[model samples]
Target: MPVLVKDYTWSETDTEVLITVPLKGVKPSKADIFSSEDYVKINYTPYLFEVFLYAPVVEEESSIRVGNGVVEMRLCKKEKVIWGQLESNIKMDKEEMRRKREDVVKAVQEKMEQEQMERATKKREAEKLAIKQQMQLEEEAHSKIEKEKQDERDKAMEELEEWKQHKQEETKTTSITNKPTIQPAQLKQQQNSKLSHNMWQDNKDIPDSQRPAPRSGGKITVNFTPRYFPTAARESTEKEEQEWLAKMAAARKIQAGTPSEINKNNPMLLKDKACGFFKAGDYEAAINAFSQAISLNPMLPVLYSNRAACYLKLNDNEKCIQDATRALELLYPVVPSNHIQRAKVFVRRGTAYANIGNHGLALQDYEAAEKLDPDNTQLQTDIVQIRNLISCDS
Candidate 1:
């Protein structure tokens, strides 16, 4: 009799093979599973599933469980060897089985191709949308800056008008208070002199090339020195001299020491300097700066994490692990431990561990990072690669 099969899924680990077959409305007690060193068979009244193993398995170690309308079998391999494919030969009509296999392979290939094309199309659409949004944001930012410039110009013009009005008011008050009883000719002469002085003062700011040329007849030169002194200096006495001496002493004190000193205890300043060194790719300088920042502010986990990154760049795996661990310890009290910063620290530590050939610790850290950033495809890939490495090593 020919063996029948049902809808199923199968997977393998380094030492075991697992198969899940849907039993659909069948009771667990109604299922029967049989196993040998090279084959597994399952029957549940209206359904059956069977597979011939490509390699030998421990029949005594094989086990089956039925739950939630499904039967799962776990077969332990006798030898720890990687299987290229799962199934062996089946006792079916040779030509019919060949045609069935070809049809299945073609269907699977077409489905995979369709899925790849769909993914490509979605990726292109996402990229186009992101570009469009970025362009819109840039245009809005430019428009905002232009509007701010226009507002500044308007404010300057308003201030100028206000100043002119204040000056005019001052001039009117002076004319009303000093209304002298003079003849029209004298008044006209005074007005002419004032107008000429105003014109000269205004033209003084203009460049010599842009100003109007003087008449060719003669040149005028005038020089005057005022006999005036500041009130503070003019009234200097014993008390003033004492105050001046005290001020000079204070100035000397500042010049002699304080001005040349730097406040190394400022954590924020140290952090800023560290970030600058990091951007410049000076890993050693960045590490020193971050170390100072951490000393000044030991509670800041980011400083430790940043120092760990610098150590990573310097290939100091031990220091990297130490700093990363310190950062995690500091971050433990934070409410949200799964932040991106924490995730980055985990990744850094995982990389350091992996570099030292400690795949077990690296896998643990990678798994933790994956929980923090589940959508990070690179982290997922790292996890898979680490698992494969562990399996190969085992």
Candidate 2:
């Protein structure tokens, strides 16, 4: 019997082998998967661009040859290009992507460091400035305190001289008008007053700039003189009274004093002078005047409160609080109806609290003030701003 032989060209599109049996020698009805006489070489489409074929098992030759069709391909293999130029372009693209990633990371790191350094520099500068400002304020306050002490001393000496001169004139007039007793104590007091007056005149000649500055280094020094306590009796004599009244009328022609129609010729004129000093930002002088006023009339809350305000401006928060507290203690229980007075102190305390960053305390004071004076637009605004700030911080 004879057998038929067929030849087939390898095709990339072929999937499986097609088998046929001959009707000739040793015909079997079944196909065998592994038999030397019953075998076929099958071709399959390559999965990717490259693959490796395994060598076929054979008995005759020492070395074997594998088929050329691809069986396996590397996972990294890409679509094959017509020319090598496309491969170079892909490699350049990969490098550029890597460079871009590195550049982005570097830029981010540099930006972060720059921001940190800038923040640190700002913090340092702010701290230094705060310290410098604090020191300057302290020096100013100290200077103001010292200057005020000197002014008080001079003013006292002036008052003593005036009293002595008045007393001496009285003694001389008495000696001429009636029998006089030259009391030794009176003589000594008179001599002392004259000496003090001369010393005061000398001190007055010293320019304020040449004089010692305030101990607290503040801009203003307060020197208060006690207004006449046992108010001096009016000098009698129709001629002299008319002359005095004429002089007072002339004085009123200039800038008039407040507390309207206050007697300009009264011995308490020093009180008004002190008020003027307070207005001039001379806390030392203001404080002195307030002290004298308080000494003469301890019932006045305005005097203490005014001094406290000056203390606050001088940055003497402790004294400010104390004086304000005293004013409130005196005024609150006695005059519960005084809203404006209490509001003023509350505003002062609130400012102190805000300056120290105690927003909670400041808020309390502001709220209290708002309750007392609902119509005060400025107070309403302050309360709103403070509440907003506290909310933000929290």
Q: Give the distance in Å from residue 317's predicted Cα in candidate 1 to where it truly belongs.
A: 0.2
Give TM-scores for every candidate, taking all chains together and pairing residue i with residue i: 0.34, 0.31
> What local lDDT score does residue 160 receive in model 2, on the 0 to 100 scale?
56
Candidate 2: where is the Cα deviation over 4 Å?
1-271, 334-337
Q: In model 2, what is the error at residue 22, expressed in angstroms?
A: 99
Clashing pairs in 1: none
State how far residue 107 of model 2 sits from its true place (Å).
Answer: 67
RMSD to the true structure for each prediction, in A, is 24.4, 38.8
Per-residue lDDT tens digits for candidate 2, residues 1-394, read: 2222232222211212112222223212111111111112222211111111111112122121222321211111122222212112323466764664455334533454455456656876998998798778777777888878888777656665665577667657675567556578766665554554355346564422222211223244354432222233473244544443454444334433464544232213434445555544356866776676666555456667777877766667777777777777655432224578888888887876776788998899889878777889999999999999899989
Q: Across residues 52-105, which tens digit of lDDT does each residue of candidate 1 receive?
A: 677888857888788988888898999898786788655456785566445543
